[model samples]
Target chain A: MLWNLPGIHVPADPLYPGAPPFLTNTFLLTIVGSILIIALMLFVGRNPKQVPGKLQNLVEWVFEQFLNLCEQVAGPERGRKFFPWVLTIFLFVLFANWWEVIPGIETIGFKSTDTALSPACAHVGSQGFLLFGQYSNCITPFFRPPSTDLNFTIALSIVTVVMTQVYGFVVLGFRLQIGRYLVFNQGIMGFIVGLFELLLEAMRLISLSFRLFGNLFAGDVLLVVISFISIGVGAIPFYFLEIFVGFIQAFVFAFLTLLFFTLGTTPHGHEAHEEEHLAETAHAEHERVASALAGAKLEEAHAQ
Target chain B: MAEHEPHNTQNSRGGGSNPYQGALVAFSLVGQVGLMISLGALLGVFAGLFVDSKLHTTPIATIIGLLLGLAAGIYGVFRLISTFRKAG
Candidate 1:
């Protein structure tokens, strides 16, 4: 995103002047986030170590956290199968979220050319910035965190929804896959469940997409507002806060994706089965109580 | 023992509470918004059809308009969904 961006040299806005194309702030952040993530993984996983070193250890620890998260939802066996997805999601989002925290990144943009050309950089015989490189930096793109982009978040959410369905197909056959959500072929109940199922899947997409987009976008907007009010120093504290929010949002997105994957594979509406279980359990308890009472009476009679 | 209550589920009941239930609710609200947006889009296309029909263009105009409106609605809905349903 840094390579291409929300720069003055380019259109000030990512969206076309009239069109609501994209919010550029988001696009650039996602790119930078992607680049950093790729670079970090390559660097950390560079050398294969039997004993292990700091880089290897850190990577391993990160994997350990991811694994535990997967296990919580997918369980021991299924989680391992689902590890790759969970890990990928965490890394992508984590990097995007964390990218904004690096200081000097957001503030460190070249002065706008218009501002420089007006009376600003034109200090009488300023000699036109002297160096050619100086002129280029005049409208350089600003580096912001990637998660801050709505496009990136939406893209991730879409991928998450797709995975849930794929897993559903994998675990439940094509027929059950239909049965799991639609139930239309069977009857009204199935149809209702199907509609509800459709709605639930839709919810996953919305929740996963909007939560990340809303949080990150809000953070960026807040930071922008703060910078305007108090200048660079004022936005300092918020930058740190953004980092924390990024971590949480990323974790939540990944975790929910994992949970949804688990649920999509399960069949629709079994509320009655649950009720039946409760009744059986209560009956068993009553039987035990009756048996105990009978034993007590027998014991008393024998003693007499 | 006190903390670990045996709140077990029935055999037919698939393990834990439906994992996607929360996702279902959240996605439903957003999806409904999307649905409404498409519905409005369809209304526009159909309104155009009414103009054609009023001019006495029978069957041809009506059929064309119906098909076009349906196509527009389906396209909008599918497009919105496709973005959110890419492969993992």
Candidate 2:
């Protein structure tokens, strides 16, 4: 069953004319997603029971897992400080990305006669859907995943990087944090190194934003292509894959946020101490593995 | 069998880290290292071009920027790998 798919466009389609250029499908979804998240959190948290219901149980489970992770990664004090920011990012991105799998997200839209935007024929197919054989290419979807939009991802990344810098200054104070980027005390090579550090920070922003955008956009295209090739059945596997991708991307984003927060807040002297701690941890792990292996060997010899 | 207790307390996993944490860190770092190098070079080239426009030294600044960016990216990769190595 061949279906005419809309031309895959990089930019999000505006929902209506004269509604301001920023009122694209992705923007609409962003607002809706934010409200949904806030409402869900409030409803679940408003009345707490000694014994939680299914909804509350799920919410609490997610929170506990992430809270543990934050504490483990950034230590108790800083992790507690950074928990809310990390959790908010994880939840928002997770839901926003999960929107892709919803039925009629890209399919349900008005057939536009605007030839400039949608040049295909406006005629609906006999099946009564706008995206029929020749008519499918012109439908402007009312809902698109916010993650697929560069604007949304870039804006989110800007917030993340800026907040990281803010945390750095807050925790490390002006002199130490500013010294990270501008090393005037040392000679020209140190100055050059500082410039490189500044450039690397810019690179972090670009990488963070584009990594998310590229993955989600590619996943969106993959789903469309798979569906186009093998009706609906072939798309099932891809749907599951997309779901997994959505979760993973959200997780990676959150983890990166937490990491950046940790790095930004940590002073240079503290970083050296952390490295020493890490070395100690590695040494301990090696000893534990060696002992386990030795015990396993002894058991095998005894059995033989 | 005794019923498992709910982990109501933090750091109650007997000092054992989350299994998924290592995997995720590795996954993210793989993407991160490659991206840092490529984007570093790209940012360098763009900055060079901008300077070239003002200074009227077209290719010279661009070349210098490209080299510096490449070096910075390599340094960054090494730094990341060392950190990972120590942690592991």
Candidate 3:
């Protein structure tokens, strides 16, 4: 029996009729992902325990890990301030990427009625399933991961970049922050550099969004192609690779966001140099302690 | 424990709270370098195209925009490297 190869849609299909076209499968999945995160947070945070249960312990460990990351990268005060934003971004992105690995997500959907397919190859099932066909893609999957959609990634990137600007204003005040892009007193070279910086800020909106979107979208296509070539046999390793890729992409998004926040909040000129120096020293000290702890744990394990 | 010592120290050197964060930055950095450059050129061309449409200069603005965008992308990559250097 021939397996029906699914069609890849760059723009998400609307989940239902009579609604806005923007209410696509990707949009619904994003909302579902958000609600899941919220519910998990609420369930975990409902009661505080002196000694955490398994669920609470897992959540706390994740929280502490990110908290340490923030403090290490951004300095103590700024890191603490930026922690919530960094954590939220990480969790949201992580879920979105992981959803790609779920079995039926992009695979299970109704046969497309509108997409023009050759009558010779197209076989629509009794229940509207696109069954065993030479056609590559005839089914419109009910769910597509949010990262697979350019819109979702672009929206997230814009929010992150805008928040960086907001943080700049909050930390360095209006004059200093605005001065970053428009420097009159710094001479022609400085002026050009400032312009480049401004252009780079706009370019980040593209870079951040496209990076996540490209990686995940390509992964989806790869899976479909690989599965098509050799059926189930060749796709196993790629699925595992997708899981790893998913996590790394999520981590990169969050880490970059944290870095941008740090850059945004930092004051310019001599103060910038001084603050960086201090943050570096503190970060080094933290690393030393972490290394020492790791060594101790290793030694204890050896002794046992 | 002895075998793991190097791995643990390496994690610390990588500059994350865990090994996952430290090592993955290298992976992310490589991807970032390529993406930054392309995006820079792409943005430049788009802006150039817009200006050309407005002023009817055709490809002249587009060419200049491409050069400037490429340059901006290179500069952006430089900043990214320095930032990571400072970070790690």
Which candidate tops lDDT? Answer: 3
Show model 2 residue runs off by greater than 4 Å.
A116-131, A269-304, B1-10, B13-16, B53-58, B78-88
> DockQ score of candidate 1?
0.05
| Superior candidate under TM-score, 1 versus 3 | 3
In TM-score terms, which candidate is top?
Answer: 2
Candidate 1, residue A283: how far the Cα is off, in Å: 11
| lDDT (Cα, tens digit) per residue for candidate 3, span B2-55 | 556554342344333666667776777787788879888988899999999999
lDDT of 3 at A112: 59
DockQ for all models = 0.05, 0.39, 0.30
Evaluated at residue A100, the lDDT of candidate 3 is 85
Query: What lDDT score belongs to each candidate, Candidate 1 first?
Result: 0.61, 0.81, 0.83
Residue lDDT tens for model 3, A1-304: 4755566668888886545978889998999999999999999999969999999989988888888788877777888899999999999999999898888898777665554543533444443334565443556778899999999999999999999999999988999898888888879876877887899888778778988999999999988889888886899999999999998999899988887787777665556789879999999999999999999999999999
Give TM-scores of chain A for all candidates: 0.71, 0.84, 0.85
Instruction: Choose 1 or 2, whichever is better by TM-score.
Output: 2
Instruction: Let me know the TM-score candidate 1 reaches against the reference structure.
Output: 0.59
By DockQ, the best candidate is 2
Q: Native contacts retained by model 3, as a fraction?
A: 0.38
Better of 2 and 3 by TM-score: 2
DockQ of 3: 0.30
lDDT tens per residue, model 1, A149-168: 55677789898889888988
